[model samples]
Target: MQRSRDGRCKCLSKVGLSWKGSVDEDVVELVQPLTGREQFFTASSCAGCIILLDGGINGFEVQKQNRCWLLVTHKLYVKDDVIVALKKANGGAVLKFEPLVLHVQRQQLQDAQILHSVAIDSAFRNSGIIVGKRGKTVLAVQSTHGLEVPLSHKGKLMVTEEYTDFLLKISKSKNGGKQEEN
Candidate 1:
């Protein structure tokens, strides 16, 4: 399953993928659980748009009739119907989906306002998430192993020098056998 930029929950259904409000979304009628491949991916139709979920990939590609389209990189273990979890990189957790679907739109492909990014955390290197948004800024989650560094997008788009010192202090404290928030 996938969570849209507006926090809506999306899942596959008999008719296709369906979206409901954030907390009330359900995939009971949308997806059938099966074995084989165990990963999920979701993305829109664009040149570099790709969401690598679970152990599979889902996104869009060009077709004869459609200028831009969504496509899945089929794996040998993949089956027709299955439910999988969608993982995001950068220390975020996974989002579950029953079945995955690809959606395409001409405007989505040509729009330059779209933001596509892939985040992979050092702790969860094996798991990653791809996000697509029109005008949303991605927030970095609090790091359990390192200091909480704040990144600003405005101005020079750089982290404060004090943040680096804070990280060093945190590291030193850890090595000195003390527990403190760096």
Candidate 2:
């Protein structure tokens, strides 16, 4: 009754935030339908993307927060983009492809699970509900199609520029295949 059990309503927060900085342009079409529904509000989303970063192998994993993001783009990239980013790396450089991801906050746990089922059916196999302290319920939807390749090591190019270009093309093709479902 007090706005919500936690004195917070994600729906209202979404409304309060301006569209310009809150949601990615490419993701609007996919989340638009759910936005109008009473039980759901989009918390965040990304259509798909490729990222070029300078990172280190910290205890067998890439320290995402500590890495330097050389380049990031939601649209398909060109060969020149990768070439420029590689020149800036002082350590290891990794090229990664990230697939579509969306987080929908639901009014009820049941509603979150219902949306989760649909996400899984639509090939977002990694979709799951996130629950924690407070009454918030969120459904995280993600596709399993993602790739990461090491492009450099010790500030030296590990793979040829041609190979990196080929990787971008492959990642772009994956995005094309996923878009058809939405």
Find the candidate with the highest TM-score and give its number.
2
Per-residue CA lDDT of candidate 1, range 1-182, in tens?
34456544332321232132111123222222210112222222111112122211123221223211122222211212111211112221111211222231112332211211221332312222223576222222111232222222211213334543344344434323353453
lDDT of 2 by residue, 37-111 (tens): 677777777778888889785644665688999988787655798899899998888888988878887789999
* Candidate 1 off by > 4 Å: 1-145, 154-159, 177-182
Scored by CA lDDT, what does every candidate get?
A: 0.24, 0.77
Cα error of candidate 1 at position 177, Å: 7.1
lDDT comparing candidate 1 with the true structure: 0.24
**Best by the lDDT measure:** 2
RMSD of 2: 5.1
How many clashes (backbone N, Cα, C below 3 Å) per candidate? 15, 0
